[model samples]
Target: MIAKELHDKTPDQLRDELVNLKKEAFNLRFQQATGQLENPARLRTVKRDVARVKTVLNQKAAAAATDA
Candidate 1:
């Protein structure tokens, strides 16, 4: 999630995305454990994506705090 999109999303949607990303992470790990993860880089990509989303969410939260 980019900062622009993250700012546009409602809090509920952000929470949902977080949950879905966590599930994806779990599946990726399972695939790696079974020796079937085709792209080893996928794990890193997803981790970074998760971080990106989290960073955007945090920024939004901080902005909201200041607004109130």
Candidate 2:
């Protein structure tokens, strides 16, 4: 998913996505340990995406705090 799209998601949705991504990352690691992972780069991409979502969430929170 794109950063813009992630930023646009509602808080609940973003949190849910973050949880799912973390689960997937865990599964990917398990697969790697079993030598079943075909694309290890996918793990890196997911980690970056998780960070992007977190950044956007923090940005929104900061903006809200400032406005209040």
Most accurate candidate by TM-score:
2
lDDT per residue as tens, model 1, 1-68: 46677778887888788888889999999999999999999889878878877887788789899999
What TM-score, computed on C-alpha atoms, does each candidate reach?
0.84, 0.92
After TM-score superposition, the amount by which residue 35's alpha carbon in candidate 1 deviates from its true location, in angstroms, is 0.7
Worst 10 residues of 2 by lDDT: 3-12
RMSD of 1: 1.5
Cα lDDT, all candidates: 0.84, 0.90
The alpha-carbon lDDT assigned to residue 1 of candidate 2 equals 81
**Candidate 2 TM-score to native:** 0.92
Off by over 4 Å in 2: none
In candidate 1, how many Å is residue 47 off?
Answer: 0.5
Q: Give the clashing residue pairs of candidate 1, or none.
A: none
> Per-residue lDDT for 58 in model 2?
88
